[model samples]
Target chain A: MPATSSKPRLGVFKFASCDGCQLSLLDAEDELLAIAGQVEICFFPEASSRMLPGPYDVALVEGSITTAHDAERIQQVRRDAKFLMTIGACATAGGIQALRNWGNTAEFVRGVYARPEYIRTLEKSTAIADHVRVDFELRGCPVNHHQLVEVLAALVAGRRPRTPGHAVCLDCKRAGTVCITVARGQPCLGPVTQAGCGAICPAYDRGCFGCHGPARQCNCESLVGHLVQLGHDANDLLPLVRNFNGAAPEFRTVSDRLEQGWPEAGGPPPERIPT
Target chain B: MTDTRTVRVEILSRVEGEGALHIETRQGRLERVELQIYEPPRLFESLLRGRPLEETPDITARICGICPVAYQMTAVHALERALGVQITPEIRRLRRLLYCGEWIESHALHIHLLHAPDFLGYDSGLAMAADHPQEVNRGLRLKKHGNQLLEVLGGRAIHPINVAVGGFYRAPRREALQRLIPDFEWGLQAAIEATRWVATLRFPDYCRDYHFVALRHPDEYPFNEGRVASSRGEAIDIDDYERRFAEVHVPHSTALHSETRPDGGCYHVGPLARIALNRDRLLEPARRLADELRFETPCGNPYRSIVARGLELVQAYAEALDILRDYRDFQPHRIPYGHREGTGCAATEAPRGLIFHRYQITADGLIEFAKIVPPTSQNQKQIEDDLRDWLPGVLDRPDAELARRAEELVRNYDPCISCSTHFLKVHRHDH
Candidate 1:
């Protein structure tokens, strides 16, 4: 939906992730004043106390639904927002805290809090899309500032956001960076993860750990097979895929396959003598 | 006949966590003041058990989004200790520069956004900004420089990936660092002015004889390294942190309250503590500004903490410039250290106060036990003490004035309750 009014009313909402993504918005210090001037910033509790009741024009929602209150809140936000964009891994796919979704919630809760009886939470931490509709998703552990600005501009101008839906391998290639996986035998996640963080890990002479979630065309099977060929066994690949973007469909599928002990999708496990 | 009253203050404003103050009054006198932390308990230690040692830096950084670098530094220091790795001089300089970014950013955040509102009598920063745009803009610009430096060096401002166990995964180029110097020079001037501006605020003349505790380095205002020291004649190395401080669990709140070990009394941390303990170590401009403002040593007044934070911002800017001037390029280090089975005790100044992290690692480099004491948790008892002392005089004031002043008192510490643990539970005295 286009902002028919003079300025778009922006609202930033948080639910269950580490508040890093929202901090990114504030981190846009040079551009922040200009951005504030361009929009009506109706509700951003983290930044402002003067919240104008919304019917917000656009909502840049961070975090995931982890509690009964959050479930209700997300629904209310969706109703209030004309166009709701989920920001970061937590809003699209549950965050690192979503590791709880795989474990027992009651036990996890008991292990964490002293007054367990006072705590109120759900069994699983799920994304905003799991409950209400998310018009678009910005992928990353902490969404890139430049990309965030682009997304906001697009929403204001009534144009589809030009956020790269491409993979990290493409970014690495464009930056003229040599593959750590190919050269140094690092088990990089570049092949399956999204592009936004400018292939930072690879440029640093280390393998990409996939802080940005899975891209649109992730072929995790081939990547996993290649990593195994390079050196990593099932044990290494399990955790590699299960990090920041662990819950995304493509990565999760490959992780599940590795755990289930499937014999290389056809033939027996490749035998290699230890050094 | 014995008279008793329990005053409960829920959801303390101008601080970070969910905490309440419960004071028990018996026989027309103050009995017990327990600062209760009700923030949802996060088992960072327990969660870290099975995870690999390399993942500790990023995992621990999640403890506080605002001061992620503090977490990163402490975690990396502990890991380096466990792994038997020593970072090079160049790496140490870069680490200090990164830490200065956090200090500038975090201090600007508290002094301008969270703490300033209380001094100016506003609900929040945005409201205060509307009334005083230029002042707010100046703060934002100073904060911008800090963010810019962090982004250029650490890759991202929060939970930066550039820092690792041995050292930074990537060393920032000299050119990138040089580009920051001009803006930082401007920020230094602005920060000095900001210190003066903050000092001008009508600071409520309320002082306490707090046993201020902070990391004190002989040559510098402690950022990355220091020996823990206090106003009340207590100094110890990082290893003796647990011996000096003790954490106790109260029946009212889930979060534990920390105090001096033998005496078991509350002590304060953060700017007031840091500034008071390291007064002589402050940089030239900071020292000059402190003198001009007449912010003498042993500053126990909690309200002057904002002024102290502003002064620290100036010190941070100077430190940043010093690092920039002494810039040198170095090859990235990746010397893997052998992990040992032992406990690591470390304390670094987080933006809010002294953040202590102690972890027991297994031989295989996995965390067996983890205990973190954030600044806000440490200040709980001291906060209640301030309320108990001040409330008697203000009990006759209108409810609105009393509540406002109470909130202002809490704001003095610039408490990042979100980082530490918050509902302000005030146990007021009955006339």
Candidate 2:
């Protein structure tokens, strides 16, 4: 059915993902009804049965491009969308599934499927921006519900979404959480990960594992050095850096460097990790 | 009139993940039904190899967002069994409490937002909220309470990071868990009211004998522990799950269809199954309210799964409050375990239904093999069977109306395609 409303049309798109990030919009328990009141939710199939034909005013794309059909499908989404925003680690970064980028995708298929011939997938799961021009990107393994609501509210209000690009350390500082890394020699990713999760892990007295992906100025070299001094090996640090944000450029470079050991004189590594 | 018609719904909405349904009717007789799950496979098992055992729960939690804690719970229990670790009693309570949070969140979302629209003739929960504002507001409040509980315990609702192999990463303070008491108390009564409200909806005349399967515990309503029990009196241990049940790839769906190991027959799992197998075990007032509503045992109608979800929601909130009131400070939040080469398996009740996870770990604690049979995969063949039985009665309707009804039938299961596609494969016997 055509949405005969004058309000701005919002379209939610998915690629290959857990559906957690887009769910953040629904997880906005208090704001969801109010959100429905404001914007005409024109094409969110997860929340609505309505697949209103869109020249969508704003499109929030979740997941990452992993299949040939979805790859072409995204181009159509880009064409139909006036303004596009990529949400969550899968769209902003390539998600944990992007770990397939390092391994043989064919082998990955063969291992899981009885007849690998039937399954069709791309060699790698790449970020949405890698495929098309994205006006904005929100980062999280699952984007924070509050941030999701803010982005939707901003899009409706015709303003830039005010999601800060600071590291999780800033959030930890604001919450007055004692740095687990400094106190207990834990290998915390808070110094490099983006802030939006409100430093929840450290607040629970655990090390941040970078679910929110990379912050603007992630000094991976320095963070790695500090962890090494704290009696953690490269093996301990590699998994932390590579996971979730493994395909993000900043985390990817450091992970590559970690995989290839450092020089005797404490210099950068000699080679890429060969993705 | 067209004797041969195919009602194809390319995209099923108001459900988790992605799927399409195709139904065929020939001469007013139901011919075939295919629930095509075109959601791209992530191949999590293939990728899981060589990852450390510690990461299993966290990594598998990404399979589905709505039921992340279900994946995590099954993973941790399976992995812990592999490593020969025993958890403290306190850890067990916390784990159960965390699961209650997921049940409330997942069930509440499905009932109010996804499934209720089918009963009331609305396209979306957002659209339904227009006239039924009070009901919608109650749903939101109920959903938020679940999220709040998750935040206090598991860290965040979607894919919480706190759950580890043997236990949680950190034990929450008694004060922290106690804070949600007021909301939970209100939520239990609210859930009962919700159940009462949904019970009033007029149900379609569709009921048939189903081989309802669920986890059955001797003492409690099963969550993390039980032997698999069915309405046909079949009971088996979790380790024997693969021996009794198996998955076969259909050409159409990215998700494999599950069937009985020997018979290749469809069986049902999820809310209705759980209720059929374990309704007597439910704590009051959820149990008492079931009597009040005159809820049937072994309810064959899948559409009435919403009532079962509502009852479960009441049970979740009631149980959650019980745990919250009893919770006190506990020591050794994460139990210590050393690496050894062994294989272990577990079955747990996801909000959707029963899920199974098995693992073989290296002596060094890296995963050697991993297998996950999520609830939706297990339910797919059964869904197809239901539609085959269902399509004939509604065959006279035009394709558009047929598509609408078919989509409603699929939503009854609340299928999560993302989880089902993770370990799917084709087994074309006649090829």
Residue B151 CA error for candidate 2 (Å)? 0.8
Model 1, A25-88: lDDT tens digits are: 7777667767877888777756654456789889999887777777898899999999999998
Which lDDT tens digits does candidate 2 get at residues A1-275?
34367888899998899999999999998888888878888888889888878799999999988999999999999999999999998998889999999999999988888778889999999999999999998999899989988988998888888898999998898889998987787888898888899898888877888888888977766787667665677766777788887899988988777776533345753233211
Interface RMSD value for candidate 1, one decimal? 3.4
TM-score of each: 0.89, 0.96
Best by DockQ: 2
Tens-digit lDDT string for candidate 2 (B1-431): 53545455667898888888765555666666678888999889988898888888889999999999999999999998888899988999899999999999999999999999998999988889887988988998999999988888999999998999889888999999888999899999999999999999989989989998999999888898999998987788888899989988777877877899799999999989998999988997888998999999989998899999999999999889999999999898999988999999999999999999999999988999988999999999988888878776777777788778878887888888888985211111110
Model 2 CA lDDT for position B201: 95
* Highest TM-score against the true fold, candidate: 2
- In candidate 1 chain B, where is summed lDDT lowest over 10 consecutive residues? B1-10
Regions of candidate 2 where Cα sits further than 4 Å from its true position: A1-4, A263-275, B1-6, B26-29, B423-431
In the range B1-431, model 1's lDDT, one tens digit per residue, is 32434444444644544455555555555555555654444445555666677787777776666788988888888767766678888888888999999999888877887788877877667567778989888998888788888888887777787878888887888999999999999999999988988888887778888888999998988987889997877689888888889876555665556888898898998888898899899999889889999997888788888888999999999999999988978875555678788777678888888888877788977777667787877887788778878766655555456555776787777665545631356655443
lDDT of 2 at A12: 96
Fnat scores for every prediction: 0.23, 0.78
